[model samples]
Target: MGEERRGISRRGLIGGGAALGVGAAAVGFGAGRATAVETERAGAAAAYSLYGAHQPGIVTPVQDRLHFATFDVTTDSRAALVDMLRAWTDAAARMMHGDGAGPSGPTSGDYDAPPDDTGEAIDLPPSRLTLTFGFGASLFDDRFGLSGKRPAALDPLPHFPGDNLRPERSEGDLCVQACADDPQVAVHAIRNLARIGFGTVGMRWSQLGFGKTSTTTRDEATPRNLFGFKDGTMNVKSDDRDALADHVWVGEDADQPWMAGGSYLVARRITMTIETWDRQSLREQERVVGRTKSEGAPLSGGVERDQPDFERAGREGKPLVDPAAHVRIAHPDHNGGVQMLRRGYNFVDGSSDIGRMDAGLFFLAYVVDPATHFVPVQMRLATLDDMQEYVQHTGSGLFAIPPGVRRGEYVGQGLFSA
Candidate 1:
């Protein structure tokens, strides 16, 4: 798509006009070649393709906003569940293309029947919206005759040392991750998908996130987490195709063939103790995160992009980067060089019962296998990281994100086929 095509305005999309369509042809022209209306239209139409080898949301550029929801399968009938997946797939495809969720769209002359779309995003652009769906381990229960089809790698995550998990917000049978530059666009996608699966599935828990916490591509600058520390400095960028294939995408020889190009998603709701962290000295804070607050550089010395010198010595002959520092414990070198793609967001939910702010990072990671990639890494952090004292893991989930859908096929079609 041209730069002009990505700039189409919401008004231009809702009210079809020649000015908006003509703007795309004005590229490389001099002054006054395109009207102001045309310019607005060209700027507002950014979108991501929904059909691909893998889901768009996994490796797509991280969006500014997120609406992630998990659902429980309410019906025991396999046909009903399959039908709902198909319906959801269709609606997702339409919504991602900047179209309404259903055939009738935002409006219809037939007043007696309810409109198919929720009408909240009628005039908005797609904003690079991407809706990713995944199946939880619980979905493979005998309820849908999928007991034997469950990928062995989809097993439930083992409980860690510092987890204060709440049962209500933990796991679900399915998950939908909607991300977009426009908050309304992301919310609308999830709301409509839930509406489409009304009778067959019920929402378990959901999270709304803002201010992305990491960068998935090399061109973008790294973002900070709620703790005011730059996160994912060594993250596997989407541009590194080889790294993505080895660390994120599942191979055909995986436990299940249906998950060939798919990946595993691990979501953790980590609540930060902002009050306690704020009271600490700047030096203490830097020690905990193991990076300079101003430059986000390693304590061992060097620029932000330089590799940390873990063996460097300090004033008292102690390691410059403490062994218990958050960065040190979570570093790939400390672990087996195993890394996952981190696409998280900073969240601030009003307050707790005692009046303290309920805010932290909603950690989301995509990996080839959680068993080898996520489990051991988290295990080390849970026991050794000093940052754990100021944060608590309150909710968690794991899902097997299936491969992308074709034009005519539905999500998870491979599992249902003979």
Candidate 2:
């Protein structure tokens, strides 16, 4: 109902003129085929609702592919920006339901006009797609008169030890994280959204990722990063309501009321020295990660799910889980009981000029507050984690993810409300 109201009556697909409209219709790919929305509602599989108390991607079950993009708002008109968001919201809702970005379908629009939906994902399943959006610190600048509403917690992340941040690939006025079981589907979502934004927003930087490195569901097995070591063994799960409330979801007393049900996102593009790491002995690798490479159990060990025993010592009377081990330093025991919902992905962008694979973990974490939940832990990891030897933080971002939307409401509507 909300989508119908906001979608369907939009005109162009690109350029300045089209950026002013905020509607996109949905359609079935072929004649007689049920629309994806209908098939999903029929229970062909589980589908995540676009309208909710919190966005879907954060806590939704991890998908197989990711297309994460950040954009620079080129328009100075607050009205134009707001309209673009509403358009994005409409497109996102339709796309998540396996419908096209616009109701005209990919080929049914006027012969002379550009098609609203990019036809790439035609006939593809929704693939459990989810689109999560956020606003960067720079968006609060005087450009749109939102200075006072900027949350103090939305401050830029401080530079950390061993950071080799590349300015060209970090930060933006807006961000959209598209994930789906099909890589093409994920890419399609981002492509259409970018197409819809056209002149109003320019793509700043983007990352394509595959093989989710972390999961938000307990039943799913933990996944390994590029280093071949299991990651996020202690991640907060979707069903852990208590943990979600305590660590991931923003509370009622947050500095900005607009972010009450939302969470903060810290994105770090960590590039690993694959060649160097591959040469390390198995024992050394396990020592650096503080877990058995194959099973992911702590060095002090019971099993993968058992709490790490940092105090346990070996025959040499040294801590079995090395003090500098990643698991040891990043453990909640060492970080004042803080935890985050990790939803990272592994990425490989071919090879570097030196002939080494230019790839690593595109780290994404959601927390109630970065100040207490992320910064300190990362600082410790930057200075103390043994994994730092092979990994370098290359690009980074901090975004304020607003709460979800109800039918007929745009994402981040709370921020614009008087």
Best candidate, TM-score: 1
**Model 2, runs deviating above 4 Å:** 1-46
Candidate 1: segments with Cα more than 4 A from true spot: 1-44
At residue 400, give the lDDT of candidate 2: 95
The deviation in Å at residue 336 for candidate 1 is 0.7
Give candidate 1's TM-score: 0.91
Residue 75, model 1: Cα distance from true site in angstroms = 0.8
Indicate the worst ten consecutive residues by lDDT in candidate 1: 29-38
**Which tens-of-lDDT digit does each residue in 312-417 have in candidate 1?**
9998999999889988998889888888999998999899899899999999999999999999999998998999999999999999999887768999888878
Q: Which lDDT tens digits does candidate 2 get at residues 1-418?
A: 2223233322233223232222423323332211122232322123455777788799888888999999999999999899999999999988886668987777666656787888887756667888999999999999998998999888778889999999988999999999888899889999999999998999999999999999888888899999998887889988788888899989889889999989999999999998999999999999999999999999997999899888999999999999899988998888999999999999999997878999999999999999999999999999999899999999998999998777799999998888
User: How many collisions per candidate?
Assistant: 9, 3
Clash-forming residue pairs, model 2: 25-102, 25-103, 26-103
Residue 291 of model 2 has an lDDT of 93
The lowest-lDDT stretch of 10 consecutive residues in candidate 2 is 31-40
